[model samples]
Target: MNKNEDSVKNSEFGFGESNDAYAKYFFGQSYLKRLASNSDEKINVSNVSFEPGCRNNWHEHSIAQILIAVAGEGWYQAEGQVAQKMLPGDVVIVPAHTKHWHGADKDSWFAHLAIMVGDAKTDWYESVDEAEYEKLN
Candidate 1:
């Protein structure tokens, strides 16, 4: 099997079911597993997994969001900045309203813990341009 397939098969956090609800905002298949949620405490956390070449569209949160890379490899990029390669233990602190997109690398499965700092309302924008994404290693 290819690296992507192998990684998925041996994923650390179990890959949840297809993220159908947000499929429209992604390029390829993605999965979501809620790790924690407390309406009263306004806390939300989820484990998100991406298939090879999968990426979410450019988007931003009303409040700051945090991403902790938990498995395999991925890429994270904000508007007007170079994409950041993500590996296990890497942490990204995205400021509120920063237009950004993130997902698996072209040849690897990836997963991250998404922590919504507050009652964040995400606003999704256009998908990452294919030409631009293809430029990445």
Candidate 2:
């Protein structure tokens, strides 16, 4: 088959169900499912785990991101805002350049699948302040 035809076929085709070893860590675990784009677009798919007392540094995105809670519970908050409690089946859409942080509760486990689009490099920032976090929870 020709290259163009192959491209169309591949796009039309789909990947069957699969999974990976959820990476374990103090903050929690993460499993990178796969890269979203086959050719050149910048898209990512990852399964993240936030253990009890685990959280991520407050950061902003060059593009947008989508977070889908697959299991457990957690919270998400954007810059200059209150945090929202999240549960299974919840979805969060974070706009570009909006600083935010998310993680599991102090005594609970949380897991979610996150997808990001745009420039792949993520700009990291300081960890969420304990005082500020307490206010949200």
Candidate 3:
């Protein structure tokens, strides 16, 4: 792992490894740590961490998704909406099928617990518009 990946892995959240499996869907480096999953219970939880300036592509879930910010700062923006700044303890409830994206701020690492309410499938769309993202603070 490179220096930045190593530092993110050792972040306060201490969640999963470098998220290479889904790297293609993200604009920059991100880590994934699966915290819980139960087929019978139909529940899934993961701690996702992003390096500074890292963000995922626009996507939507078949079911609602809940993101609880655990460390640093980030941005969450739904289609046609202004990006929302997120910090520790901030929560974002993303309605099912909403085109949106979330990731670390330009100068901060970000971590959040993603709780999947049920057996949700995600449909990833194009990357967030670069010009639009750069406009965010």
Best by lDDT: 1
lDDT of 2 by residue, 1-137 (tens): 32122222232222212223322212343323443553366667766655455677787778889998765667888988778887867999999888888876655566667788667555777777777666655
Candidate 2 wrong stretches, greater than 4 Å: 1-39
Q: What is the total number of backbone clashes in candidate 1?
A: 0
lDDT of 1 by residue, 20-66 (tens): 99999999999998888999889998889998899999999999889
TM-score of each: 0.94, 0.71, 0.90
**Number of the predicted model whose TM-score against the real structure is largest:** 1
The CA root-mean-square deviation of candidate 1, after full C-alpha superposition on the true structure, stands at 1.3
* Candidate lDDT (C-alpha), each: 0.89, 0.63, 0.88
lDDT of 3 by residue, 60-135 (tens): 9999999998877899999999899988789999999999999998878888888986878999999988898888
Model 1: which ten-residue window has the lowest total lDDT?
Answer: 1-10
Candidate 3: segments with Cα more than 4 A from true spot: 1-13
TM-score of 1: 0.94
